[model samples]
Target: MGLSNWPDICLGSLTPLLPEDFPIDEDHEFKPDNFYFLKGCVHFKNTAQILDMTNKVKKSRWRDFSQSFLRDVDNAAKKADEEQEKPKYEIKSCGEMMRTIKTMVDGQKGEKICELSMTFVSFDSSMVRFPDKEHSRHPLEICPVEAGSENKHECFVRHSIPYFWDMSSQFGTLYKCLNQKRVKIASICAFGFGKDAVLAIEGDQLDDVCALSTCIILLNGRDAMDH
Candidate 1:
């Protein structure tokens, strides 16, 4: 989707989050002032950074080195300690179709923050659960605005009113719905490709956890398709 083809309302929604002079297109990257992506690590200004992926090669190297010197009993204890020290957020596959985003607390899986499910013929589904008295579950339905379009990058994320809804363009912008109104929240440039793939998040209108988790799920889905 090109900038000229974007609906006026969509453009209006992005004004507050993106600079007026910034170009919106697949080739033009979105760079938010506060958020940045670095080697699978998400860094927020003055906030805690999250590691998106654990290094498997580093783990293997450590195991090989330890086996050459450390005893089995000592090696096993060190491995357990390292696992507990790892980041809390994790994305685990439940089956061929479903995946869950979990947060660890006190060395145990704490909350299932979000769940994503794949579909054979339609857009995928994502459910965001709130840990509250009502235990609310919000469903985000992904639908393509242009029918039969091969650009897998463009889609609309529909959810309950006055809560969460999103419209994603091939240009990488994710607009959020607020009280039936749309506003830009995040953007992903060069999605699912190379080391240059970047994600930029802006403002505090939407929950950060939901925003990040959803972006990861979308990017992972695209990566899976490419592979």
Candidate 2:
């Protein structure tokens, strides 16, 4: 999805493996959620410097760098061709079937960072869950990878839902995900329009935000499609 002020972050299968007439499991008793259990990639335009930032960089410096980049994008009018030429990063992964799941994002320089991964912890679905909806008994566990590291689990975000009294208008509301120390990494506010949502991410948590937002967008898209 393209953000007006930031570089567009798109999620899709590089190529379709299923046939055009593949059956959609819309009538399943459990009802389908937005999470995907197939293979695909998360694409985004990024610079080498931003991707090279070390975890040791002070939070203030990281925030400044991220803000500076956003300012540059907002102030400059990028030509269509120039914008198309920006370096693209892709995180590829395989879902289910395989006992192991590992995904990484890589830039033109060929460096890699694990975007997210889920290994076979247990046969029970509730054992694995998303960070945003921690209160619910979700079946999948998505662990976030620390900056500059592949397959390293640093922390997970917790998602809480609105109270019953507020569910009418505020249904599907999402607070930002927090680290183990209760630090807010990113904030997402989704309105009733499904795909029409806003994401506010901090400078130091760009990578984490990117990974988290991918899942959110997929879930949003699923809702839009069903409705």
Q: Give the TM-score of candidate 1.
A: 0.46
**Ten contiguous residues minimizing lDDT sum, candidate 1:** 41-50
Off by over 4 Å in 2: 1-82, 98-102, 118-183, 189-199, 205-227
Q: What is the C-alpha lDDT of each candidate?
A: 0.38, 0.27
> Model 2: which residue pairs collide?
125-139, 128-140, 128-141, 129-140, 129-141, 132-159
- Lowest summed lDDT across 10 adjacent residues in model 2 is found at 159-168
Counting clashing residue pairs in each candidate, in order, gives: 0, 6
What lDDT tens digits, residue by residue, belong to model 2 across residues 137-161?
Answer: 2322332222233222222222221
Candidate 2 displacement at residue 124 in angstroms: 5.6
Runs of candidate 1 exceeding 4 Å displacement: 1-88, 97-110, 120-137, 150-171, 177-182, 190-197
